[model samples]
Target: MLLRKLVPVFALSLASAGVSADRLKPEDAVEYRQSAFRLMSFQLGVLNPLHRRQAYDDEAFVYRAETLSRLAELALEGFTEDSKGQQSRTQARMWDEREAFETRLREFAETTAQMAERSAAGDSRATRDLFRQTLQSCKSCHDRYRIE
Candidate 1:
């Protein structure tokens, strides 16, 4: 019982040991946020063809969905401080409408997480639907808050 109690405390401490989000330098935050999106894109590439029936890699689909969920979370963390740099596609509106930006990221993460759960259960239909919802969330945010 003591070990079990200690284990919970230890786990919480370990989880909280990650670099504080606000400690990131502006350029580092901007670069990491963009990199997180790229990672999500690569993971999506793994799922898309299989999802479209061009491939039958069910295991890859599940793995990619799980990865995308984590990537969404990472993206959220990276965007914690709106540090749009010279090379960033993020719009000034992101900081201007900060709460809305956060809402979009949260929705994306939630939907992607649902997709991951459905993919793990081998439910292609639900996975595909949730995947679309997650992408729609991305597109909606990009439309409003990203620049080409």
Candidate 2:
């Protein structure tokens, strides 16, 4: 399929770009971050019902968790100084308190990574716990750093 071929090429381009603040436009950063978050939310939303029903599709859950972990890692890169003035839900306080925001982002990335590892290892209980923690981390960060 065209998609199968293009995906690798697209990924190669992104990898070669080694995206940095200087390389990203403000609007592009906003779009990139928003897209990453939306994709992550979609993965979590799927996982949520499965977790609640205690129905584990082992391979699917691992796939979603791995996707979420990758997205979490990519998400923070969108918060460039250039993106501050863009029309977005990101709070000024997030940019103002850069250290704290970065810390929270790091924690989120770590949590998602753990969730993926647990899922892959067939540790359902720990995966569920990490899922809850990941959701809580989103709420906690949103409360402080995102505008409604």
Candidate 3:
């Protein structure tokens, strides 16, 4: 009887844990842009901590890089759709810039993945260079597409 009671309690806790792990999706353009921005912030938060000499992990570095890349791509994606609002900062020209933005994001992701591989192989210099390149891409996209 005690075992059966414990099983249900354990299963309920596990189910709740999974629900808590689920991320909330943004429902509008403004919220989507802000979500993208927050994702980039999170990537930046993880980068230095995961990439430093004493704190490096190839898997973690790759994960953060991939996350940053996805956020950049999503930022552009949010702009491509019509934002049914009068106060959107998304320029009409963003549709034209979409392809280029996607290319840059892909390149950034690939470079960072390479950096992770190099880090795994113990190449510190390559890792640093790749990290800089990744940051540059983020800045370039934000400069062109995002408005305060």
Candidate 4:
């Protein structure tokens, strides 16, 4: 989790593992937030079909869940700035209701982390249930705090 602490610092200079070369403007911050979520979605998305089809092996599920957990960590960091610009769906309440937003964000992150642990333990049922719980938190937060 040392990486987590370093992300916001690197974000100011806007550099990480070949991610960005230029300094981050507020608009760039907005893009970073969106891109982080998109990547999180993609990680979950790949496993979704396997979930429905019940076709994936235990290793795949664990790997994806672990990846999802890491991505969730990255996601919280993206919201460090009050980034507002065209195409940003972030509501003012993200900054205004910072405590509430962070409360839910932490809950979501913890849920994903739990999923990773359960998946790694070979508990597919618990992992899948945790995935639903995680998704629900995502929806609930977006419903109240995101712009359509």
Compute each candidate's TM-score over C-alphas. 0.79, 0.82, 0.59, 0.74
Give the runs in model 3 whose Cα sits over 4 Å from its true position. 1-30, 49-59, 73-76, 84-92
Name every residue pair that clashes in candidate 3. Answer: none
Arrange candidates, best TM-score first: 2, 1, 4, 3
For TM-score, candidate 1 versus 4, the one ahead is 1
Q: What is the C-alpha lDDT of each candidate?
A: 0.71, 0.78, 0.60, 0.69
**Candidate with the greatest lDDT versus the true structure:** 2
Indicate whether candidate 1 or candidate 2 has the larger TM-score: 2
Query: Residue 13 error for model 1, in Å?
Result: 14
Q: Write the per-residue lDDT of candidate 3 for residues 1-148, one digit (tens) a residue.
A: 1223322222122224454212323346557756876887888788877656544445567557656655654554444344434356555455577767657655765676676666667677787788888778777766886565
The candidate with the higher lDDT, 2 or 4, is 2
Q: What is the lDDT of candidate 4?
A: 0.69
lDDT of 1 by residue, 1-148 (tens): 1223322222112126675778777778877878989999898777777768833227677667767776776777777554654457878888788888877776676677667667768777788788778768777888999897
Q: How many backbone clashes does candidate 4 have?
A: 0
Per-residue lDDT of 3 in model 2: 27
Clashing pairs in 2: none
Q: Using alpha carbons, what is the TM-score of model 1?
A: 0.79
For model 4 the TM-score comes to 0.74
Q: List the residue pairs that clash in candidate 1.
A: none
